[model samples]
Target: MAVRGFLRGIGGKNAMPQGASADGSERPLKPIAMGDGATRLQLLDEFEAGGIGWFWATDDQNRLIYLSPAAAANFQVSHEELIGRPLTSLFTLENGEDEEAAERPLPFLISARTKFANMTVKVDAGGDPRWWTISGKPYQDANGVFLGYRGGAKDITADFERQRDNTRAAHFDSLTGLANRNRMTRRLTAILTAYKAAKRSCALLMLDLDRFKAVNDTLGHPAGDELLKQVAQRLERIVGPKGEIGRLGGDEFQVILPDIDDRGDLGELAHRIIQMISQPYSLDGSRAIIGTSVGIAVAPYDGIEPSDLVKSADLALYAAKGGGRGQYRFYSNDLKDSAQQRREIEEDLRDALSRGELRMYYQPVVCSQTHKVKGFEALMRWEHPERGPISPAVFIPIAEDSNLIIALGEWAMRQACEDAAKWPADMTVSVNVSAQQFSTDSLPALVTNALASSGLKPRRLELEITESVFMGDAATTDAMFAKLKKIGVRLALDDFGTGYSSLGYLRKAPFDKIKIDQSFVRGSTEDDNSNSAIIAAIVSLADALDMETTAEGVEAMDELALVKKRGATLIQGFIFSRAVPQEEVLEKLADGNFVYEPNGPEKQRSQRRTLFRRIGVIHEDHRYEAVLRNLSRTGAMIEGLLEVPVGTDLVLDLGEGQLAICRVRRSQDATQGVEFETPLISDGADGLCTRHRISPYALAAAGMPLAALPPGHYAMPDRRGARPTDNRRFMQVDVGMGASRAA
Candidate 1:
């Protein structure tokens, strides 16, 4: 009989008795009596035993009632061993065709006692790693009871592995071995959805490599690719296990930090990323220096959604690049406005020289031992018609990025030379040089023209350059230096120890002076900082080379003392005097005396700037208005609390997102000196600010999910709906308005 004939014969009418049996009941199919039919049945059994398709059955208890002999042989087990075992125990289900399917296939169907078809499963116990595809149907008798399951299976190990490999390829980046954008975006969405319910915080850092294009342009794309690999490795070291890092393609990357919201820690991590990534990289013996700029945004504060948060971080990255690359910034609402303002400023800077809106201010660099002015460093002051006196920190970078730096540099040099020529012949005038200006071929001629036009000797003019000038072609830098040396002007290396300090450049470059960067002096008064020792080492090295050392940004008396004690030849900072107008320099010289008095604070304390702004004085539940006469890092001098005894605790609502818990350390008349419970930290520049403010996260529970603190007086939101109580201790008085009667 044919194969189809054999399959139909088992259920044929002739194969079983169609009439009633001896008990007058319907009879089921029995064995066929034909010899060829038995032969066909034997052939089918032989096919199953010859390692072809297999069959299985289970009882109502899900115990395997039967197992194919060939299938058991392939499992390297005997038929008796698998016959009575549970089906799930023989193989683990692989969640069906959907690689990312959520529901567990086999167990779910088994628990429901439902029928399933073509479920792929991995063999639990294996020799060469076996996988099997299984199908089953729940069989029931006339009583409607689930008697058992009859199933069929076939090996599918090869096909399943091929699909697995294809899935991995789609989810990962080939270059960095990080999650590709597709997978990361999905992961972020899932995580944020889950985290939103839990009310947890997450942080996102967006990064773009600075000067990466320069590397790719100089070297080929292959080198750029190699550099990216190194960058990913360094990032892994810094962010190990803290979060997931994904390369969003090219030089841009994103980091997902779960449960981290502290800006201070984020800022530090961002700083480390910039610093470490900016370090020199050696690719096939060709040295390259590239930096990174990072922008950070925290969840629920920056954005509740991924796109919004990513945009916030991207805007911050734009701001960081605009502010000067190689730094990091936290997301702020003002960045958008600032970006536009910067663009306008960049445009205005183009004609600033011709319009004469820029002027030079002279900061006296004093001789440490004599406390007399040895030189004046020419600093640019942009007296913008609208913005008024833009900081060099802000405008200089913009000018450099634009085409204005070369012209600005020329003007500064000529003006400084002319001014120094009019000053006492013994004093020198130093001028800063941008990397772009120094790299230009016209710099040599600019220096020569300035000296000749001003009728000043070259010895009286000094040129200050940072280490960044050495980043370009060494031959060009060498030639530029030789030309300046030929002009016989004194050279100073400024902002030393802030970059990859290659001593080889120090050895070759003809620098007459070494200017220690302000970073080393920032916390040198502390016993723990290695900055003091580093400063000492720099001074010693400079002295060994017969180069004068000037410690820049010595803002405190203690810093001044420390630098001078460490053998610094000159000090330039606020402790001595701030940048003054040229007329003041003339006045000091007119007296024929170079002695300049250090008119700063008497003691080496945290520097305080005097202010006359009003602040809220909170006592218990009542808030009083008081004048903030002066503010420091650790304390403030407030005037208004009349006769407030020393040691009285108060909270100062320093408007615009600051609340300080202070204790009155001194009380005289209406003036009180209050010390902060926590000292303030730097705002990445000369400004001081609080480290952590009252979070908007805590405010949302009170019915306001504030994105940021508003600029106005804010009372602490009362969480409980209880009776109000106001305990007024001190009488509210305003001396400016003539002290009123006590409340």
Candidate 2:
């Protein structure tokens, strides 16, 4: 409608309002025939004054021409003050305030000279937000000359706010107010997509709470929820603005760290997370204790896609759990194999309890001054049907994950106590307690059962628990200690200052002994290590607390001397004795003497182990059979080589592709000691091997394209046959069974 059709003129004659009529003229204000035009205008004006809807108009320039009295009052401005103001000054399209309406519609529609209807935009009053759904139509005269725009607006502030809240609820976890899994998934996908193009790095940390189910089962669901909220708060504090943390349902969480890939930094972060989460939580005044395992994966390195990255991180997490809870692991390509092996081990461990395959070996812990054994620490050993001896390192964590640790713990306790009953009355048996087993409520009952069944006094049984045991409910831990102490068993803190190290635990927990971990003992005798100082401090601390200190993993005489000088009250290491079977222990004790002679190298050095395996020694043309009596990083002693002169070069075929090129340094009748050309390196376990193997590329040139050398003796084709001339350097001789060597 033209502006003239809507507004009456000021003169008695009906004149066109500004920019209204087609011609600059007015119609005579003749007396109404049927309907009264003036009266109708009055009624429309009254309706516009009502507050139901607001009427507004703007000129071609978008400046306000007129606003209904009601609309003016709502903006707290009079009509005269609002009239010449720009329309855009009153309203703007929401800047992402609504998912549907992203930008202002008025300018675009007006610029196109088109009509618009029910376009919602944000209107401002003071500083509060007000929403309005405005409908407008552009006006033109009969000549098609543009006039202005007229519109009516309805407030939609309530509806708009409600929708925003609903969207928020949908994207966030209700209990924790952290991003839910759905939001996390989208966020990760988006970040990975963008980061890949930019070649930037991101790290994702996957974390799962350890022993959370026990807390839920013990404290009920409400308490569990409260604990989760507390955990979210802690994560937020740790992560802060550096990353985004999301609760991935239940006890799992995901943290997205941008622009970080250094493993050392990630490791430190993982450690802090482990420590922070392991701290006790107060749930409704009843303490809840739990730990978390972290697995970290980085972008463009571990994965370029979100799903793959998550899977990689998950594998690392599984590895962390398999390595025992409360630790972190970075994703490695080998983790897939490890995870599969862990599954298989878990399955095998279930049947192990019934298969009679589990056994215990005891390592003597001796008094340093007297060299008399005070007690034995029981170490669990498992032998698979086909795998032969499976390391405790590989199987114990599998048992823990399979929820079989409690059973294993109970059985070990019973067996150790039973075995100790047959030992000398002065000897004690100390058994290790897993974190899962230590947190069990039935632990004291199991101990009582073991003691009663074996008819052994409680004092003869020692319980070794690690620092992880203190990670649970404080009251529960304290009570368990009280109960065990009341039963007359001694409590020892194992591997102190190596894992979860905190002097505070020593002050509160009633421990009778502190076992210095091997990590501190391994290099303590060297000048470049702090292990010696650490040992001294630990010994001093233990003495001040009226606790005994035991130095573990002393491998050399110098280590022994260092530990002794540091005031270790007791020592448990290979220097004293490797863990021995109970029968052998009985045999040694039958002599009525408990003293052990420390028979080792006069001068301390790296590990030199005694062995008695026959190997082939090749010299020039012939291979001689000899026994490797002792092996070390630098040299070895071989027996059964007759009259070999010093400075002779020989190659000893150590099985499994290892060929030691050595020069005879010392010679004697049927015994010659040889030093290796290149020192051996650790094979990542409790073993050593050649650092550089024969290259497969070289072997390929030799017409053997396999990955490694075959297990037997080999030599290059030569003119000399098996029986060489007397001038030839060597000859082959077989050392038959029972290590009887012939050279």
Candidate 3:
């Protein structure tokens, strides 16, 4: 019954109402008339005692004047202790999405002397997690003097937590706990917009697993889900607080790195990501191996908008995968064309062999001590009718992706054996066995047939294989190895010391030689890196295993000397000779010339790339078009500026937001050699670029509307009949001819 009805009945001389006490015993309510002071106080006492709500009052100073005794007990504090405490000491308003609401501090509300209702706040009750919905009203005294708040509060912890959990579920991925696609998209858009205004740089990385589908197909979807979780954890560990990582559906992921544009640092991070992700994984007592390819794009330089930047990165990723798995590539403007070209090559490659456009060339591998030819490695060449010669590095990965490598490998093995049969009796021929070819049960039979058809001795044929062939079932891999060994042919580990090298496999596999990768051989003598030590260790290990070691890519005499001194048994590189046509090799051997003397640069020096492309050269406020003749990490050579003086300062606009400050060190007629003020860093490829660039947003702030970086220098005037304000300092020269001449 309502309190008013109960009170009215009590004073009507009817009957006292029955009520249940705290101990569940029946009790009679004391008779009291409606509007009586005792009745109102008893009503409030019952409300507080029932744990539905609590009353509090504060003085004009906002300090507590009174609080319900039961509320004080809940706080684990005595009523007297809380009597003089500040009202804000017990509760604080939580910040909410709407800033203009009761999210304001409790102190502000009391100070404003305004009524506030149902403001959710955090309850400071002895460190226990609790929330309360509090309502309060400010009052005035009889003399019109201001008074503090009279408030009531009720617990709302459960309700508040449920809302928070729902919000989190909306933004996070339930499987991996990373940000979902929607949240990632929103976050990237917001960040790009804010950073554009701030003129800051951001990098976006797109990653796709190389063989993720294989895992899902073989191990089951549950294991694939588990693998994705592990991948997220590993990425989190590597990225830390540097950026945000998100799973962009399927086996693809993205990362947003703000305020970072240095390609050097980005390349290193990408490399680490590939290496860490490529490591072996264990799932449900089964072992799996997979790799990743990364494509990176920086903001403002690559694109001013989010969609454009994402497209640029995706193209770069496509290029990286096209180059090979387990690699990273930085986005460049030309990648669009490169992507189109890659598709054309893939389409054309399907019928290149049938058209008889493929041929095998051999590069000699010679003894380090005697410099005499011991063997030759078979390399494939594709002479495209319309596109000219194509490098194997470009087409091999394409062939592998299309499942055409098996046919290509079989033909190469047969042709190489046929060619080797005409060579010297003691000379051997090495044919590469791709991972796809080695995985099949027909490889040994294929090898046996090639040897039989060519009438070549079994001992004269060597199958060069990479470490990737080991990424199969251990028993199956061992059986393949045993069959190949039983075929009476030799085996050599190609590109050893690269890619998931393990001594455990080396101990059991029967191999005749180990060919050190070129990456370790280059610059071993030029820098103070540990590459030299690594080379020595590989040779020593090969010697201990009674296997010959060949150092590859030895182009300079200093590198040759170092590798030889390190006890390498053989050498294979440009220092001897690049791969030549099979006919040329046969002709040379027919003349009984089995020795190729070492011929290369006496010393290894910094690599400089030769090119002839138009670039902008700026002096003062004038920009002139020039042809860049060559480029290096430290400097460049340019033509089209006649009689330029030495020590002249100029800026070379290398396009795509790269403005390189440089000084002319050598000037002779139309040729000028310049030294960069700061050394250029790698462009995550075989090129150099400035570490930082001007953002398009900054240009927009300077009167140009925001857009992607346009072609040509920023200060280049319109070439359609634009006049120069001052006389040109240097004369223009025509370098298009074989030589530079006056224009």
Candidate 4:
């Protein structure tokens, strides 16, 4: 069997030729008897055809054989010369006893063959190291024959290099050639787990670029992308060997510093990051500048788990952003509260309109000269069921920023129009329009729909637009105003003196009214030179344009007087009245005797007289029986048991079928104020009074006393005519005496 194996090696092929026998017979080995031998022969032929050389040899005992082209090439010998050489002599062993370390010898045992047993051996050709695979088998005869060793070698250097490149790409950032998020996450997870086990501290710092979008928008995306790459490089330099830096995403990065020395290290890192990122970056021959805000979460203190640490870091990032950019913040509990509050407010604002918690209140705008109600300006108010009343000063800016003002404005228009429908025909209602609301093309449609639904006359509805409304494109403003005017809705320029371009707005827009801002009103009352001049100029401009002027925030009587003197047609302020409920407005309207007195000593006296007269008349009527009282010009007081609510208008019947209309000025217990709506006496009744022999006393007592009495007859003085005590002086003296007695 050994001799046959040696002969097979010398044959230089895996199979015997046809018509030959395996027993050294002249007949060749049959194809059916060749068990893998044919495939091996084909593999060898293909290798040789491809310019690969081969040789075969037997081990020292001549029991096994090895075949391979690589062996001849390594020995720097031709395949024919190496054919029958001893397999052990084909290679040299550095150490005889170090069998495991020795190069895999040829003619190795077949039973020991492994799928991929890699080995390196030095060949005689320049003594170069050659890699190989050695498959070994035990020698046998006939069907059980096994070769000593058989293997094939292929160059794997290029393949190994390609794999190395792929591994690098998978772990590194392509742009900056630094570690990427995946690699960073893996490393960070391992570090965090190890640190937690050992109870050590570490810090995770998150850095985000501020105003980076602005750079991208203004400088183009290429410049922006370049800037990010430069930022990553800077971060890598700053962190150096102390920590690992990674590009988490665009304009965002993360740094992990494991085994921190002290808390100061975190602060130092934060400062370094800020300093490095804040520096200007040059891109495409142009300089670009941006800032970075960093958030740091420390292990064992901020969080124990990786997810918790990341969350805390994110919270800190939010805090850094909140405190303005270009700064760093550490994780803290306060940030959690702030985040929660912001979320809640944002959520509530989104649902505010749907919740139906918003309302509009109308405050009367009175004519400065006539002291008559001219119009009402609708103001929005928000009453949150949970948060109570939120000030307009607080929520208005928020709404504007969030683009919620558009919906709020629409709601206000609809509500104001509905409320205006309930007012007198002549009274107009004005609604404030925000710049955002006016910018919408749907504004006019919204207004038109509101008017149609509320049955409010278009001419009686006014829109108060701020100066900012006209600050945009002139053509747009002109078109908008034209559309609004075409709808027959009056326009008023509100806060006329408060804005920078008020005069410009006024000149461009044809407003029916110009409202002097409250700041001007407040300042004008104090005789502020600039504010007063502004007001005067506005008033003059209004007069020139045939436009009415309204003064807002007229808190003092002097302000009202000044506005009236300045020819302001309307006045709205706390002095006249604060905004009240609809019922209160109706009550004020019914109280025809109600008069506004300016602030002063004499004004107080007159107000007291008015108050006492109203109270006395109503109270006397409630106390005395069969005594009808009418507010006459004289002092006579009549009493009857009746309840007249304050501000109630009623008709009083005097003797001889005379009647007079009066409104309740003051309540009698639960009674209302009264005012004279009509008088019983007419010019034609003079002769009738004289023919009836009725005296002027009854007519005078019924609130119809004339300074120059018309020609009339006399009536019974004691019953029908007013008694002689019905004198103005007597009422004044009685009121004075009653005041003194009460005191």
- Candidate 3: stretches off by over 4 Å: 1-146, 716-723, 737-743
Tell me which of candidates 2 and 4 scores higher on lDDT: 2
lDDT for each residue of candidate 4 in 1-743, tens digit (9 for 90 to 100): 67767767787464576566765479644454457888878877787556444434344344224555644555666767766665445443222222224454443532243333333332334554443323333344477554444444443334445654687687778877777888777877878777755756677888888657756765688888888889888887888898888887787788888866243456667777786776656677655556678887766556666777788888887666655445677665456886775556556877888988877877888878766787788888878788788766546655764678898899899988998888778889999898778878999999999999999999999999876564344577789999999999999988775423335556778799988888676646553347777788889989988899998877766667777777788888777777766666667666663344443321111111221222222121221112333333221223332344455544443333223346656655323344455322211101100011122333445555422123222232333433433222111112333331110
Superposing every Cα of model 2 onto the true structure, what RMSD results?
13.0
Best by lDDT: 3
List, residue by residue over 1-743, the lDDT tens digit for candidate 3: 57756765666543443475535578876777776998789989999988899998988888899888777876867788889999888876675322323345667767888898988888778667788888889868999887877889887788888886786677778889998787788788888898887888899999999878767865788989988999999999999999989998999999999989888899889989988887777787766667889999988788878999999999999989888777888887788999999999999999999999999999999999999999999999999999999988789989988899999999999999999999999999999999889988899999999999999999999999987776566677889999999989999999887766778768989999999999999879966789999999999999999999989999999999999999999999999999999889988898898999999999877788999899989887678879999999899999989989999999998987788999999999889999999888876556777877766766776667777776656653222134555666877776786565433
Candidate 4 whole-model C-alpha lDDT, 0 to 1: 0.62
Q: What ordering of candidates by TM-score runs from best to worst?
A: 3, 1, 2, 4
Alpha carbon lDDT at 237, candidate 3: 93
Tens digit per residue, CA lDDT, model 1, 1-743: 46545644676643434565645589776765677787787876887777668889999989998887778777767778888888888887676333446765687788689989878788876677788888999988999999989999888878888886677678777888877787778777777777777877788999988767766765678889999999999999999999989888999988999988767788788888888887778887666777788887777666778887888888888777776777777766666787889899998898888899989999999999998999999999999988888888788878766768888988889888988899987899999998778878889899999999999999988999987776565666788999999999999999888866768768999999999999898888887889999999999999899999999988777788889889999999998788987998898889878876666554456778889988888877677888999888899999887789898989898764567889999999789999999886544334455655555566666667645554565556553243556566776677788856665
Runs of candidate 4 exceeding 4 Å displacement: 1-343, 590-743
Candidate 2 residue pairs in clash (backbone atoms < 3 Å): none
Candidate 2 vs. true structure, TM-score:
0.65
The TM-score obtained by model 4 is 0.38
Tally clashing residue pairs in candidate 2: 0
> Distance (Å) between predicted and true CA of 716, model 4?
87
- State the local distance difference test value for candidate 1: 0.81
Model 1, residue 174: displacement in angstroms? 4.6
**Highest TM-score among the candidates is held by which one?**
3
